[model samples]
Target chain A: MPLNISQPKRKNAISLTPLIDVVFILLLFFMLTSSFVPWRIVDTPLSVATDAPAAPEERVNVILTLKQNNGQVWVNDEVLSLSDSSVFQTLVSDNGDAVFIIQAEDGVTLQSLMSLADRLKLNGAETVSIANAFAMPEAK
Target chain B: MKIAAKYAARKANDDDNMVPLINVVFLMLVFFMVAGQIRKADPIPVIPPQSINDTRAATDPNIEIVVGADNILYVDDVLFTVEDVQAYLEQAFSSAVNPDAFWVQIKADGDIPLDSLRPIFNQVRLAGLTKVSLATQLEREAK
Candidate 1:
């Protein structure tokens, strides 16, 4: 009589090494990209209405004020010299859509404000809002 | 004879089947590279002020005005005087649609003077823009 022989079964296993490598690479890429991104810092007063906050569409606030000496003006805290066209050019170069909020002083001349407004209009600031400090006591 | 045939078949296919793995890795690499390319830069660096309750989500393609510790102003990375800011906004408004939909976010430092922010608000209104937002960090009280 001839002896019968049986074949051994082979196990199919999924390889995880490639998947893990891909995941680690993706994680590293995100970490590096996030670090290079610029961050913005702003200082502002608190609002009373916690229930209704400003919409996301309206978030860029351009703080404008005049310096005490020689009536030199500062926008968002940066002093501007009238002779420099670059300053005005830079203001208009913002690619992102941002709301412009003008916070002028009580005694600030309208002429200065108007002149600045004209430039902002050229730069693509679609929505510009004026903030009246006197109207809101909380702002003080 | 059956056992010998089965073993021979198993050994025939085991020589470095890494082509498929390489193909998948390369595909993912290309996918991430394309995705990373589309991200745009933020116009400006704005650290919003802290609020007891800040529930506002971040907006996309929005303008940011950052107020530094020394009360310095930056609009989309460019430094401007109060007058320059107004002029910039005015220029921006002429070409914008509805002029009323534009949103300006102000991120002011905690120690900055309240008086410093006055002119910015004034000019925003003058430009005919009504939508404005203040950025702030949410305060988490210690438990």
Candidate 2:
């Protein structure tokens, strides 16, 4: 028996097998690597400085306290706005060798404290230390 | 006519081939290894405070200590009571090549009180890990 077969016609179709595979792979790669929280680090003043002995030499010390309840920073008896750079400038000018003793109440964010400390450092304060040691936050 | 008959007679062998698939998978695996760090996720949600002068560290932290909301402590995403931290650090420091040079990163929530973080610092100090650092992100203005 003789079989007569017509040659198959070429169809205009692009193969998507590789393309689909690549798209899936790329999707999976991003899903695995992306973190819900992209945590970064900023170190604040030394909290351990509370244990260190007091300085032998009498140097200027500016006290700043953070009351978490009020969400305001206090320098001595006066409330200070963090927005003002001149506050730091005035403090630094008063005593070039001044040290800022920053004390924050429980539940205050470390980020805000660190920024203030950094600002002090930038304004020429030789040392900015956490005045009080860390402890368990008061159960509120 | 002979060539067409020959081609039709043999089954397409390439349909069963998986070489390209395997190659693509291998490349993806390598990309994940190189492009990302595999650090454990912090159990509690923490919004780290921002600072204008914050600087990114040159190296990844050797140890991760997270202070979550409600004053809970986490060491490398593993929950640790305040009491357990000293012992844990003792082990980490003892195993390190340079105990004194060992770097620590503290990731604390913005509102985490200083009192809540004190014990962790003490524990870190007791372990003789002097090179302690607090982790913070860049301020939005800086970003």
Candidate 3:
């Protein structure tokens, strides 16, 4: 019997292993680079006191107390909402030297505090400080 | 005979294919390790407040304070006490690698009322570390 011989046909095929490996690398690159919650810094005024030349007319200090009265915010003793542009203008308009002291009551949201801060800053209340008034007494 | 011979050749090449796959994966893993910021996990759960003025992406910091919604304080693994935390911060600041460029960040929960947050602010101030920043979730990019 004659030995049978046949030509072996090679099938054309594209391997997906490299493509999958590349995709995995890309996925990991994004996972590592991306931050979950974009963190931003809101600069709070420093409590450091600076000595100034006491002028003939000293700047009148304004106290805009933030107290939650019946679940509402009272800004500068006025039941003020952030929407009222008049209240922001009035609080910051009177004098150039007016330094607004924000005395926020415990349980008042920072959301409101920040909004009030923005308004105070926008209306030109040069320096705004969060009061450490309610701070606990120093330990013996 | 030819078909059997061809099958044997292809099997020989497939034997060492895993070596190249491992090499590519190793390179990618190293790339991620170098490029990412690996922050210490917050001790207590903190959901930072949202802000309309949040613009800048927070960069590297010298100190970080996490304020939970329930007003519990956590300085890394240590349970923060009023005096201890202050003293720790004071020490950290004084012995800091770069005091002039030192910065601190407070990661406080949005639900934490301002009143509840008073002591933390006071402690930061009393530590003689002025110009501390309150952390906020970046709302959007500026136009």
| DockQ values, each candidate | 0.05, 0.30, 0.33
lDDT (C-alpha) at residue A93 in model 2:
81
lDDT of 2 by residue, B23-141 (tens): 67667666665666665556777777665554667777778888887888888888889888878887887898865467888888877667677778878766656667776656656
Tens digits of per-residue lDDT, candidate 2, A1-140, equal: 77777557544345646765776677586657555444555444333435788658587777888776353578878887776778878977887877678877766667667767767776778877753434334469
| TM-score, structure 2 vs. true | 0.68
The residue-by-residue lDDT of candidate 1 on A1-140, one tens digit each, is: 77676546556456656665776687567545543212332223334234686667546656655443233558765887644656756765662456666555544433344334444554556654433431233544
Give the alpha carbon lDDT tens digit for every residue of B9-69 in model 3: 7865674575587677767666666565556567876778766555573456688888788
Model 1 interface Cα RMSD in Å: 11.0
What CAPRI grade goes to candidate 2?
acceptable
lDDT of each: 0.54, 0.69, 0.68
Question: What TM-score applies to chain A of candidate 2?
Answer: 0.59
The stretch of ten residues in a row with the least summed lDDT in candidate 2 chain B is B8-17
Q: Pick the candidate with the highest DockQ.
A: 3
Q: How many steric overlaps are in each model, in order?
A: 88, 10, 1
Q: Give the runs in model 1 whose Cα sits over 4 Å from its true position.
A: A1-15, A29-140, B1-46, B55-62, B77-81
Highest TM-score scorer: 2
What residue runs in model 2 are displaced by over 4 Å at the alpha carbon? A1-14, A35-59, A69-71, A121-126, A131-140, B1-40
